[model samples]
Target chain A: MTINKTWLAGFVGIAALGLAAPALGQDKPDNLTIISHRVHQTVSTGEQGGDITKDWQDANGVGVEWVTLDTGALHERLFRELQLPETNIDIAFLLNTRAVDSVTKLLEPFDEHMAANPVENIDDIFPGLRAAMTFDGTLYGIPFRHASSCFHYNQRILDERGVAPPKTIEEMIEAARQLTFTRDDGTKVYGFLINGEGYANTVDLARAWDGDFITLDYHVATTDEGMMKAVTLLHDFYEEGILPSNWAAIKDEEVNNWMQTGRAAMSLNSCGRNRIFNDPEKSQEAGNIKTVAIPVSEAFKDKFDVAPAKVEFWTMVIPANAKHKDLAWDLVKTMVSPENTLKAALNGNGPVRASTYDSAEMKNQLPYADEEKAVLLVGRVPLPPFDNAAKASDIFVEELQAAVLGMKSPEDAMASVQKRVTPLLPQ
Target chain B: MGRRFIYLLMAAPVQVLLLAVIGMPAIYVLWLSLHKTAFGQVPEFVGLANYGFVLSDPYFWRAFVNTFVVVNIVVYVELGLAVLMATLFASGMPFRRLLISIVIAPYAVSEVIAVVIWKYMLEPDVGPVSAILASLGLPELAWTTDRWAAMTMVALLSIWLHLPFSFLILYSARIGLPKDLYESAATDGASAFDRFRYITVPLLMPAILVALMFRYVFAFRLFAEVWLLTGGGPARQTEVLATYLYRHAFRYQEFGVASAIGWLMVLATLLIASGYLRAMYKRMLTGDA
Candidate 1:
């Protein structure tokens, strides 16, 4: 099993020969490498990959390359590629979760780009969306997609159970309990389908229960009564068979599948998922899936009209080491153009531009446009975009899972989360 | 002395390359472990602070325990299965070509693909395996929610993906064993089990030790199985050393702490390898049957 000197020499020689020829990239005129997730590309350009560049090449004689990766890989790739000594990646799409303070340092701020050659209707983008792409009063990216959270339920189940749509946190729990039962086909449908594993599902629940896990100013609110109530209720629901038995382990993709296949009755999902949940081809509960603003907690009804839901967005940025900055800026301008904004919104993107919702066609086509607009007005960014925000989010979820799974008391779990996460957050 | 110097000279290129590729990075990481480092931030000399923090963290101990238990399950169980298969094949089993191909098929699959395939196959509600198990009225695998079940599932997967490696090695050793010893043992009226225990097993000792040594090292880095499947979850219950290192390095951006954990893993690996290495050396030196 050991390599002798002669054999090792031969292997090394061959490997050296192979490594001698590194790939030398050819830079062509007006050619740029753009990296993003597939849905982001599709929404911005109205095509998944090809022909968007083709049209641009035909019109402006400039070609673009799209490198699509999933969310985690996209963030990692962009982060690594931007810091490289030489990179061909002109523009990259960053998710809101990753658009933190340290990352903006590696990106080209658009303050100068906007001042010189601003995209049309620059002021039309929603405030929340604008906030996601900004750091220290400077814009580093243009918002492309902003999905606000919404409470989605199966209307058929509600009708069958003779329960009204929940308008408060307690009522929502009661309705979820009523919704949990066996259908005619003997399929056991859980009342709720929230992912107890992560910040996305439970953060909104914290707000609906009238508290926050962490605020924009780095405040840890885990010991707040509202936060305690949120965790306790989630635990109670799981124990009572309201939430799925595997709620602590359920993924975002699985939550979508549960709603589509009628395995679960309700979820705190993004407003954009309403389209997928009601797609006749993909969902059995099509047309029966209903959307509503997350209900405010009864105790805090006087403080707020409706529950505050967090918005996660995607924005386009130019890498600091980018070769073709002007072309990248042009592409970003084209993507954020008023016409393309409306087009992307129609193609299932959550519109970042407010004026897109003002169009009659947008209003007519997007049935929940007004509902989404209301959520958009009040939507809060999930975190403060701190250096270790992702790490903090991860710590919160670990404690939350422990709480939900009955391994720790809710108070103890939240206290643990607060203790562990506070050290990672900015003071 | 002249001939020895020539051999060293001939091996100089590869030795230097190994130093550059392996030794240098290890040294750099050791240096980083003493400082406080993160991406886009300057490393501040905080000598051993990261080590202290990581050592004190309960999750680190949890990861260590998970790695130990899961790896023991994978390596030992896989070694047992591999020996059984190698013996069966050596006994002139029927349809050897077809059976070997089927047995070794997992070796061709990439780790990511294997994880994806198993993730879907074991999904609780709709996966074919789950459906079949439910129809048979068997107890359901709550891999997603239950910590014990999740760890077991990861270990099971590691065994399946890696069994082919141990099996192939053992099979080669078994097939290469001299026929004369077994024949002579049979002529001396030794039973088949007696012959196997005395002749076959004694000869296969080297191969078995080698397989254990390699499998132990391979199984220790049980990252993808836990990460992709459970994400160290149902609250970091199935976390192993590799995932713990990854979470710190990538998610937390704590490069300094990650390096400390990485060095700790290297030390742990060396400790494991030393045991088998010493055994193999003893066998070689003593010429022990």
Candidate 2:
């Protein structure tokens, strides 16, 4: 009887052990899938796509699968996956425009994760960035890149016109006129370059003129007096031929080409694009490209302490249904650790932390570092997230283009925008 | 069991498969269209609201018109080019296989790659083709800003890429056509035009209609050409139904409206395709054309 009982106990122990083996394996998933744009994927990749995830993968004994998607598709996929109980996506990266209530509810809040596995110095991150990602005092995402709008221009063209970079919007207008010329090589240089149909940049330009399109609290100001003035100014710019004929259709890639080939004098683009314009192999006018703070509007020069600039940033979030949240947090820590943040900036990511710009190496190595830092302090995302935000943007772009293209008067266009967009705002 | 009952019993598995693959999705989309849906939000019943919005939206009509115009141009132009090439191929042309290979090359290339190639070639500022046009003192194509130019480019690219599909169908039919009919017409001193008009046209009508049915349906869903090339920009002037649906579905997250637009596309396609099906489908099934 004693021998039989001992044999039963041994059998029960073995059976229990067999059941728990798979559970133990489940604790450490073999792979964590992260999706972002190719450019933003460089964060896991070291400077210029060096392998930064090697140490993390080695430490965790799990592979990192990086999937790159365009900005539009990223938002779509993130939302779709989060709704599923079984999701392949462990981590996701999002732009500022995607931080609306619909998406935030689907994100795993970072309070518990931060308490257990802290980022190097959470306080060192920009207050605005933290605030933007926080909903009702719960953090949902960590800042990955903050690209501030900066003034970029052809130095050779400005020099040829015998004028320095314009400091005020009024001066820039005059400067653009003088700068427009035909080179000996028959290249027709426009004084200014812009994607006139783009709502983000158009709104940024309008905002600088004190034209408020929509306030963060869902206030509709498209028909405000300031916006009328902005429309008039832009229409006048288009009429004077300061902007290219294809300005209404030129997207970001064309803007790069226009500037790099020495075909345009000035543009306001995210500072990250500075690298593309200044790279010798990619640009014919590489060395001659210069960066500065966006010129202040004449109206707001005395009204504000700092110049107005537009800042749009991207962030990293773990989905609510993520299989390995703890592991994802660990990987996030490795990327945003104090030591790697500076390295990421050097590798061409827009640095999110204020301390990154303050570092001695950052100030020395990056040419536009000071300008970017200044812009970050003043700039905010051109449009904030709302339920109907994308629709609002489309409506604004339509009206803005109408005014610029002479289809409607600036007054009527702004009125039409206000009428159409106000309905999209939350009551 | 009766004959009809036995036929249904034998067809049950395939009917079930068709239901699983096609009918269920159509029903689900129909349900979705009846409600207002967005990400992470409970779907609320708003019967006919999405369709109402789509009908009232000016851009929807613009996209519909653009789809009609562009698809017709692509189908007609592609068919014209295919007929020309098929005739040339039948005439014992030199280096026929090389020319055939060259003609079919674009069909094999993926849509994204083809768009990228054309975008570079037609780029006004620095494209090789644009440069050639400039040297010859021709007016530059402002496709980026001009609505008509953008539409022209979209039609041109669609024809270039899908010409092969139409050409193969017509080419096969032309070869299969009775040689004795043409020989008899020639022996009777019929002109080449007369022979072609009477013998070739009457015989190839079935193939032509077949090509039209497939091309019209496929071309109506012309998303990539307009999406990649023009993005329906310069004030939504060049938008087609597919891109319009995409904007609502993906960009704005308005699934309800997107589903409604999708159903409208289906209805439009059916209305257009019903004509050709009624005329030629019986002949096609009987191999009598």
Best by TM-score: 2
Runs of candidate 2 with Cα error greater than 4 angstroms are: A1-41, A45-70, A85-91, A110-123, A225-230, A303-306, A321-337, B1-20, B108-110, B113-142, B285-289
lDDT of 1 at A336: 79
Which digits, one per residue and each the tens of the lDDT, describe model 1 over residues A142-238?
9888879999989888887898989888899888888899777757888888765578768888888667888777789989977888889888987
lDDT for position B159 in model 1: 89
Q: Write the per-residue lDDT of candidate 2 for residues A214-315, one digit (tens) a residue.
A: 876667777776567667877887788777665666778888988998888998788777888999999999889898877678778776433556778888
List, residue by residue over B71-145, the lDDT tens digit for candidate 1.
998999999899888988998989999999999999999888998898878876557888889899997798978
Can you list the residue pairs that collide in candidate 2?
Answer: A46-A50, A47-A347
lDDT of 2 by residue, B1-289 (tens): 6999999999999999999999999999999999998888789999999999999998999999999999999999999889878877976789999999999999999888888898878766667888899999997787766778889989999999999999999998898988898889999999978987888877888999999999999999999998877778766778899999999998798999999999999999999999989878667777766
CAPRI grade, predicted model 2? acceptable
The DockQ of predicted model 1 stands at 0.33
Give the DockQ (2 decimals) of all models.
Answer: 0.33, 0.44
